[model samples]
Target: MIEILELTELPRAKAAGALVADILQTMRSRAAVGTNLLDIDEWTKAMIVEAGAESCYVDYAPSFGRGPFGHYICTSVNDAVLHGRPHDYTLADGDLLSLDLAVSLGGLVADSAISFVVGDARPAESLAMIDATERALSAGIAAAGPGARIGDISHAIGSVLGEAGYPINTEFGGHGVGSTMHQDPHVSNKGRPGRGYKLRPGLLLALEPWVMADTAELVTDTDGWTLKSATGCRTAHSEHTIAITEDGAEILTLPNHS
Candidate 1:
């Protein structure tokens, strides 16, 4: 459903966004070379409960995924890109890790994701992929504002990734977030400008730009959740929840801590 939040509800949205940002930053610090994926999940759960917030992912059961995600956060590693279900694997040096999180606080929801290398070993290809997604995310946010078309944001994002030489995958990109995790206005990674839904004040959109190393195709893991590159190449994803405002698009999921 398309939800246009009232100004009165914006404070709650900001609080939710702050909580998501804090949690993601904390998780990034804790994810090390030997850390277990399940351990990260536990850490996320503890923080969510401590903050008196709810996890949007724990009960998320979309048609494309297995019912009830049953996890507090998504831990995608190396080749895994989206809907990465935490498993019994330990992270290794140079592994590209992506953490995607969504949380509800004060009756509002915000979502975000970040990709980084695990330990002391930073692979050039992995770092490049992460940089491309991050740059694309910034471009998308820059194109967002009241009266702007969703296609404008999509086109901006696609340009960055395309110039970086990564294939755009439209199967999943960004979406609206509000009282619930996912909402209307599916934002593609690539599209024509001046088309699709027009942006308006009070609208919250999670603009994510993700790409596989060399292909646009994705394959689901046997676990029925984790989506990885069809070619088994590395991947990266970056995202932020933004609010369309009179001045411009305000990023809600920026880390509050230094």
Candidate 2:
């Protein structure tokens, strides 16, 4: 469903977005060598409960994944890209970790994701990949505003990633988000400008730009949820939730440290 928040709903949306951003930043700070993936999930659960927020992932039964995600956050490691179910694996030095989170507060939901190195060892390739996604995310947000088409944002995102020589995957991308987590219209990472749904004030969108180092093909892990690169190359993903407004797009999920 495509949900357009009323003006009154904007405050709730902002609060939800802030919670998501703060939690993600805290998790990033806590994640380091020897930290177990499951621990991150537990930490996220506790924070969400403390904030009086509902997890959009736990009890989620989407067709693409096994019923009931049963996890508070997605922990994609190294080659893993999307739908990364938290597991017992411990992080290692230089491990590239991606955390995706969504939650609802005051009846509104916000979603965001971040990719970073786990420890002091920052591989050049991993650093570059992370930077590319962040740049693409910024480009996408800059392209969004009232009267703009969804394709404009997609094109802006794609141009950045394409210029950086990364393959794009369309199977999973950004989407409309509001009261619930995932909604329509689907926003692919790449598309032609001036096509697709036109932007309108009060609409919320989650714009994510993810890329694999070598190939766009993905292989699901045995857990039936985590998506990894087919070639086993390192990957990175960046995302943010934004609200359409009269002047332009207002980013809601920026980290407090930013």
Candidate 3:
């Protein structure tokens, strides 16, 4: 369902965004060379409860995923790009890690993702992948505003990824997010501008731009949660929940410390 939030709801959205941003920052800081992915999930769980917030992922049962995500956050390491369920593996140096989180606070929801290398790792390829996703996310948000169409955002994001020589995947992309984690108005990573839903004030969207290094295909892990690249290529994902306003699109989930 599409939820066009009222102007007053924006503050609640920011609260939710802050909670998500703060938790992600905390988790990334605590993550070390030997930290396990499951541990990160546990840490996030405590913070969510402490904030009096609810996890949108734990009970998330979408058609594309198995019912009840059964995790507090998504921990994608290296080849694992999207929906990386917390497991028993410990992180190693130079591992490209991605954390995707969403929560509901004050009856509003916010989502965000961050990709970083663990420990003192300086892999050029990994950094480039993360940079590309961040750049694509910026392009998408820049194209969003009142009266702007969803396609415009998609086109802007796609152009960035295409220019970087990465293939676009439409199977899973950005979507409306508000009172709930996932909502209507699926915003593909690639599309034609002025061909889809028109933007309006009070509308919130999570414009995520993710890509695999060598292919657009994704494979589900045995856990029925983690989505990895078909070619086992490294991947990266960047996202932010944005609200359309009179001035332009306002990003709600930027890191509080950044």
What's each prediction's TM-score?
Answer: 0.99, 0.99, 0.98
Q: Per-residue lDDT for 40-144 in model 2, tens only?
A: 999999999999999999999899887789999999999999989999999999999999999999999999999999888969999999999999999999999
Could you tell me which residue pairs clash in candidate 2?
none
How does residue 232 of candidate 1 score in lDDT? 96
Q: How far is 158's C-alpha from truth in model 3 (Å)?
A: 0.3
In candidate 1, how many Å is residue 173 off? 0.8
lDDT tens per residue, model 3, 101-165: 99999999899999999999799988998999999999999999999999999999999999999
What clash count goes with each model? 0, 0, 0
User: For candidate 3, what's the RMSD?
Assistant: 0.9
Write model 1 residue lDDT over 70-144, tens digit each, in one string.
999999999999989999999999999999999999989999999999999979999999999999999999999
Largest lDDT belongs to which candidate?
Answer: 2
Model 2: lowest-lDDT 10 consecutive positions: 61-70
Candidate 2 residue spans exceeding 4 A from truth:
none
**What local distance difference test score does each model get?**
0.95, 0.96, 0.93
CA shift of 20, model 2, Å: 0.3
